[model samples]
Target: MSTLALGVIGNCTIAALIDPAAALVWGCFPRLDGDAVFPALLDGGGADAPAQADGRFALTLIDQSQSEQSYLPNTAILRTVLRDSHGGAVEITDFCPRFALFERIYRPPTIVRRVRPLAGRPRLRIQLRPRFDQGRLAPEITRGSNHIRYVGPAQTLRLTTNAPISYVLEERPFLLDRPVDLLLGDDESLEAGIELTARDLFERTHDHWRNWVRSLSIPFEWQEAVIRAAITLKLCQFEETGAIVAALTTSIPEAPDTERTWDYRFCWLRDAYFVIHALNRLGGTRMMEDYLRFIGDVVEDAADGSLRPVYGITREAALDESVVPHLAGYRGMGPVRIGNQAHLQIQNDVYGAVVLASTHAFFDRRMTRPGDGALFEQLERLGARAVALFDQPDAGPWELRGSAAVHTFPAVMCWAACDRLAKIARRLGRDDRAAHWRGAADRLHGIIRERAWNPEIGSFVSTFDGSEMDATLLLLHEVDFLAADDPRFAATVEAVAKTLRNGDFLFRYVAADDFGRPRTAFVICVFWYIDALAALGRRQEARDLFETVLAHRTPLGLLSEDIDPRSGELWGNFPQTYSMVGLINCAMRLSHPWEEAF
Candidate 1:
């Protein structure tokens, strides 16, 4: 129970990861990329010690018997119900309150928990441990009449509650005749009665999310799953700045002892494009619009008209990679790395993501900064960069550091950039510019057809002059670089299926990466393969595989970034935006029509 399972709760300003028992194992303060105050998810990894207590905020129920978890119907709120053998039950509701307020989005840096006695009186203890600088230090706690303020170097946190402060502080069980409301924030005081304020906040939070879910264009089939995935993706967004992070926690390994852990708490240009695409399909346009502004800021500030693969939430350019020396890694795996070095890699695919993501602004009338002649000029610079780097060797989409190649994935993205820019040019009546970009696209298309294709292997490879294959090549037909019906595409699909596909999952690549060969399957790649299968008219098989992957999601109907292929166990960062986007996209593409269901 010490290991952090995949239940997550957030309100866009911040998020927390927990287990089924509702232990706060992993989360940051202030924002997604901030310091990891709860490092137990990493430090306590697979430790089976019954007394797990360090670096966690959890309800320590005394005389606990049975526990289970679920979400508050169509909301991001998490409910963990614990029952004692003596016929007493308690329900713990965890969420970060957010709703429309002051004619704007009200997403505060807060985490809310409400404990209620469901049946008879229940006894529980609250274990609250606040840390600083990724577990390198602890914050000083100063007590107040109704609250305790934990002042850290970076920020301050307040826990205001109705529960006895001494009981909570000493980790002693107390009878819960009624509900105890707790609010963790720094902005304001809850001078009003705790129960009254908490009840009102929970109601508003519930109403806000249920209404937001109502606005989604979810497929009729798998509606519940799609709704949950959509909520998780929205939670991953930093609404204040409109930046969508890849994942919440950092240094959760992709595979056991593989050294594949990464800090996914920052936004990546490539990942955002797919996120925008998935949300667009589900009719979640507000998120797309907010994210566009985030991307626009990055694009507008591009150094020398070139874009990097990743950027910080506040659009910070420099993210130096290092390890937190004090904390043990997730599952006792040491050397928990902080920050990311991929910021320095040459990922040419980002140029395409920039143009593709911005293309919506031109046509979507609802955009705040709708595309204009000036914006098109700004985007053209990115297109030119894509064309220039189309055939150059850089890090592939997987961010491989040990080697470089003229990867097929980035090459096709470069083609997509030219293709999209040409269409945009034509839309704006710039016929000359249209001709130039299209000509570039046509030339690159020819080059990819020639070099990326392996005549001997009877399929397209991961890179030009390479027989090696990676999961990203599954997207060849997705970008329209090749038609699904094209025999070449079919052969490429079969080739990747033979080499990278293992059972229902697909490996990113079997070739040894920086940490040696990957031992787990990336869930999103399987989604891409399923989409490809559906496109190729293998609908039934695709649907079956899709179901198997769906069953692999965490109990709370969410997914992490990676999964153990050998044991079918979930791993890596929590509530991965990429994985959730895959669920939404696949369900939309493969589900039976609403009319058919009826």
Candidate 2:
């Protein structure tokens, strides 16, 4: 059966998910949101093998008995070792070439595979099958001297290989006496010898990743875990547009047999803010700088200063939801969605998200271009909208479809918008504007404190005057809505921990929603809870829970959106950016300071 244990390899431009057996199961071509040229991940769930589907690239070892997979240290390069029963083995190295070329970052939508025979005469069969339009269109295959082109309606892909094209085209098993290099990318011709080009790219790409990882200010403790999460989060960014996707592949159910799937290939302002904030903590300012460009475009495009919850990778505002019937969902879950309707919803939190993310650029002297008065004035427009709708709720951060409430989280986020504007104004020496925003922030703060608190429950509820707790309530301290030492804030934290704790995990909420109630734990909630615990001076408890959460990661040290509390199985989208952001945040908070450790 297919699982989220798959490994991901990509440049910022594109990524592919490879299963334990070294099969290319899921990938989008040209760009991250383009057609799924390799869609075996969503073809059928619980199948004996992905071979039952057609959209995959497999390097199958005859009489294969054991396999092992791992990332080349501190890099996105994936290494898989497969061994047959008769001591025959082959090593497969996979990566999308990303490095410096021609005085610029060179990241193409190409996947490079280098296979080397490691043991006694290994026999291998190479199958490269790519589909288009969600598996509804089969491309016209044409063979050249050394390359095969798969021509589709919108785009064409070329597979250039040093191996015999006849063997690859015929799917014939052949002896792997030497290393084989295959490059699947654009329809362009190779510039140099196949071996020389592949070798140069491999060396440069490896050096690029190592240099990039060396630049990160990762925590000393759990270095491996942090690096992996950081790399995965970086992979989720669409470099061309500077938009960070919520995940790679979508429509993976949050739990079994639930139609709770939603497309996450687009950018959610809320998720993007958290992603940038986490990366900033690691000294990854380049990502933040790139994302600011995307956010600036989003702000400029919002004529009314009202932002949507999500947008397309290329800044397309209209993300109409539609189902793809041609493809089965993750685990055979049906109704694979193409776009997100959340783009059309009124998500008030987005106002604050934009300001919070932009705030970093204004104060950091390290920024190449700091936020100036014009940007502050532009953000004030969003602040106006935040003030107008802070309490009048639409879909909250959870993006509930059937219900809209005066959710406390969005209300607090709106408060943050006003609060940040005040700080930014002070930084710009605009005393009058600062005073005005500070007053507005104070008024909203008073209102939230009075209305969001359920005195009987001793907690700030999910909604105003509602007696329910959700995991987001734990963010009161993290968001600076309340002080950690405040008795009310501590009480709210305890209330949420008591109300939402499942077996070893924390549920987002237990209340019934549009899809009955969520059965599994939202993975990021556990990290939020850990951060809250640490802020409350329960460091030991926080560290223990942080370790527990780390243990639940897939073998590749990756996480999905949700997890079964009872079984610890991952669910939802692959390589969820929210989950990775949480892991990075919690590791930074819980790790012992280097000065103390040494």
Candidate 3:
């Protein structure tokens, strides 16, 4: 059976997910949100469907017996070792080249694969299938002596390789007598020899990642985990536009065989705020800077000073949700989706999320272009929107399709927006605006305190005057909505723990919505709970739960959006940015100080 036990390789512009057997199962070309050239991750179909999907590039070791996979330390390069039953073995290295060149970063939308013989002459079979139009059509293929081009309607992919073209084209098994190099990218010819070019790119890319990792201020204890999570988050960023995708792929369901699937290839302000916050903790402000640029464009384009919950990577506003009927979903599940309907949602929290994400610009001296009075003026408009919509009914953080509520989380986020704006105004010496935003924040806080608290339940609920609790409530202290020592905050934490906690995991909510009750635990909520625990001085409890959450990560120390509470099986999109951000945040929060450890 297929699983999300995969490793990711990317250059911040394009990304691919490879399975343990060194199969390139998922990748988008030309850009991160572009057509998936290799879409086998979502092409598993019914009994009548072909046994092997026609959207992947698979390398099989003949009579394979065992395989192992790992990443090079402090880098995104993945290495897989496969050994056959008859003592033949091979090692496969996969990565996308990203390095400094010509005074700027050179990150191409390319994937490089190096397969070398390890022990005996390993027989290998290559299955290279490239699909287009959301897996509805195959690309037109043309071959040259040393390269093959897969031409699609929107983009063309060229593969330059020194491997036997005949064996590769015929999908025949062949002896791995010597090392082979394959470069798959834009339809461009290489100026240097394939072997030398691949080698140089590999060395430079390796050094680039190592240097980047060295610059992070990772926690002393969980340094490896933090570094991997940081790199995964960085990969989700579309560096060209500074838009950070919530995840790389779309339509991977949160649960099996459900309509809960949605595309995560676009940027969500709420999710991006969390990602920026986590990366900021690790001293990676470049992503935040790029994202602010994306935000500036969106703000300038919004004539009415209104912002959508999500936007396309290039700041395109219309994201009409569609179904790709031709491609079966993961594990034979159906209804693979392309665009996200959440772009049309009234996720009111986004106003505060944008403000929260931008607050760093005003205070951090490291920013090249610090937030100025002009930027503050633009953000105040978002604060006004937050004030107007804070208590209104709309889709909550979970993005319910059929129901709307005046969610407490969004209301609190609105308060945070105003509160942060007040601080920003003070930083700019705009006393009048500071006082105005301060009053606005105080009034909203009082309203939330009065209406959102359920006296009968002895805790704050998901919505105003509601009686249910959700995992997002656990963020009260983290967002400064409530103090950790406050009795109300403690009670709310207890309420969330009692209502949503399942075994060792925490569900986003227990209430059923449009499809049905959610069957898997939202991974980030558990991390939020751990943070709350640490803040409440339950260090031992927080550390124990943190370790349990770490155990659910894949072999490469990556996580997805959701996981089965009972089985610990990962579901949802692979290498979810939200889940990885949660990992880094929790690690930083829970790790002992380096001085104390020393």
Candidate 4:
């Protein structure tokens, strides 16, 4: 019931993270950026153990012995089949319905749970525990004929169901004779029969997602993984404003007692850029197009030449970091934080991220808002910021806390900004601006080549004039900063492969920063290394490593933000979009051609 390997179901507006055994352990209300109404996953009795099943909403099969779970292929709908020793079984189908209604997508902040007896007689107990105000207050409940209303300080939640209301209120076991539907969301009366309405919604939602997945230009190999990752990534996007959250849960420590737990519920421009870019490869342009609005608003709203690394999903600019003392952290690690502080720090990489994301809007003919002169002018300011800070000391992409250094990764991203700007300008027929940005790119590239390369170490170091190597350099060829086989880039990759590599994973960096040497691997960095390996013509080795990494994924075929280097156990936040993007991108890079599949 407390598995970290959980399935996520959402409707672009709201999301719920359910354990393998059909328990809703973690989920926010209203939106992805909202407060956690269920934070049991953050307090699992002290040690690094799976959460105790008490604080979550669960359907316990009284006669059940074992269970099996899977998603309805190509959709976010989850199916958990609970089987008892005496041949009694029931199937629980969970999802947040999202499909086209009247004229627009009807993605409400709602969750639909449908339970049906599959074989024999199945008895089940229902437990619904919902806390409010960031797990600080437990709401009082009031039940009517069939719906239950839970009213808290600031919000109210209503659950309309076909199941006996008294059983839900008293947590009593009931016999399963027919189907029952549990719909939780806005306080509204059901229009049709509960079970029938839920089934219709499920069918429509399934068709919507399946049709969407079919539109993707997926790679030939690992089609299923790619599709799931793609779907999860899409669900993470807040459709209201086109913002993408990094992950579902927050304050899940990067390592045991490392104090590296962070709030990833907000939108990080850098992370969203990577997500949009990855989805773009699959011909998923709608996400990109929607995100373009977010980017434009961010750029336009900038009072000065600076933009935040992260922001509130609903366009709230400021997010001051703080902890929730009431709810113990994940695994009972204290200091469950609410907001992120990286917003106030300097991160030059966002300039390039914005520019990279903006490129699609300008050049892609299918886009609604193709880049025009005005948009380009607004972006020019971002390009100028990148040019100014390429060599300045600030927080790098890794967001080290203690000190700021002229990290090579963000510097190269700056180069990418100007370089991409020049390309966009050329496409727009602005020869003068193109030449200007091209000159700036060349200048930054020259600086990086001279300052970042350490001949003594025979590699491109993480920081300028420093010797420590990190996995970020694995992206050298990815950004076109260096060619795949460039001797210097090749040697840098080899050096990282020797130093940062750990079994099938790669530590983001080896050196101690603010805290100390990282105890685990940043999972995405390993996929970056895989890309580096494949680029180096180490196809067989890359494939071997890719398979090894895939084996480490949780049973649900998903990964967390961080992985214990020694145990290969998922460590950080659950259902990390970064890790999922890695899965899709690596699968695209390493999988065999569709032509050969026949």
Leading candidate by TM-score:
2
Worst 10 residues of 1 by lDDT: 44-53
By lDDT, rank the candidates, best first.
2, 3, 4, 1
Q: Provide the overall lDDT of each model, using Cα atoms, as 2-decimal numbers.
A: 0.86, 0.91, 0.90, 0.86
Superposition TM-score, candidate 3 onto the true structure: 0.98
lDDT tens digits, residues 314-417, model 2?
99989998998888777788778889999889888899899999999898888998999999989999999999999996988899999899999999999999
User: Per-candidate TM vs. native?
Assistant: 0.98, 0.99, 0.98, 0.97
User: Model 3, 14-51: lDDT tens per residue?
Assistant: 99999988888899888899988788888873212342
lDDT of 2 at 35: 90
Model 1 misplaced regions, further than 4 Å: 1-4, 45-52
Candidate 4 error regions (>4 Å): 45-54
lDDT of 1 by residue, 551-591 (tens): 98878888888887778887777778899999999999999
User: Which residue ranges in model 2 land beyond 4 Å of their true spot?
Assistant: 45-47, 50-52
Best by lDDT: 2
Error of 3 at 316 (Å): 1.4
Error of 2 at 135 (Å): 1.3
